[model samples]
Target: MTADTSMTTVKVTTEARDRLAVLAAEKGQSIGAFISGVAERLPTAAELDERDERTRQALKKFGIALAISERAEGEALWAALDAGDDEALLKDPDA
Candidate 1:
């Protein structure tokens, strides 16, 4: 079978299993579906690193080329954007 069609088993403690069952019941999802959802929403180290790089690129594009180590300015910009200010990164990228 191809990797896409392969299946694997994971052994968990009874408590953990019961917890998963409860969560699945609450969501109206089968254990398989619930597990899949959990796995899909999780980000790997590589994904986070890539997102950081993308953030840097986006900042640079907007003329806010602060180093990655300097997260204060970027966090503020993100906060403004989160607060519904679309011009946060657009108005003064140099700021």
Candidate 2:
């Protein structure tokens, strides 16, 4: 081992060994160089983003869900507006 670098021998599974060999060949890099490059440029686990999304989920089991809001049903006013009854709208504020 030198001050610049130290080599440590380690064991890997047959599948891992084969995959490393293929990757090294494809990238035109020796096995040692490929492994070293991977180790040097590897992204941090904290930097990796994981998204969890669910469709048509039921959150009832977890806890009670509060109602967002209750909108006033201004059905009559909407109906008058749809009919274009300007006179009726002015006559009755509710309508």
lDDT of each candidate versus the true structure: 0.82, 0.61
TM-score of each: 0.60, 0.42
Q: In candidate 1, which residue ranges exceed 4 Å CA deviation?
A: 1-3, 70-95
Candidate 1 has its poorest 10 consecutive residues by lDDT at 1-10
Pairs with steric clashes in candidate 1: none
Instruction: Give each model's clash number.
Output: 0, 0
Query: On a 0 to 1 TM-score scale, where does candidate 2 land against the true structure?
Result: 0.42
What is the C-alpha lDDT profile of model 2 across 1-95, one tens digit per residue? 12567687769999998999999999999888899889767755543322111211234346644232311224456777789976655664434
Question: Per-residue lDDT for 47-76 in model 1, tens only?
Answer: 877888898898899898767666666778
Error of 2 at 44 (Å): 2.2
Q: Model 1 lDDT vs. the true structure? A: 0.82
Residue pairs that clash (backbone atoms under 3 angstroms), model 2: none
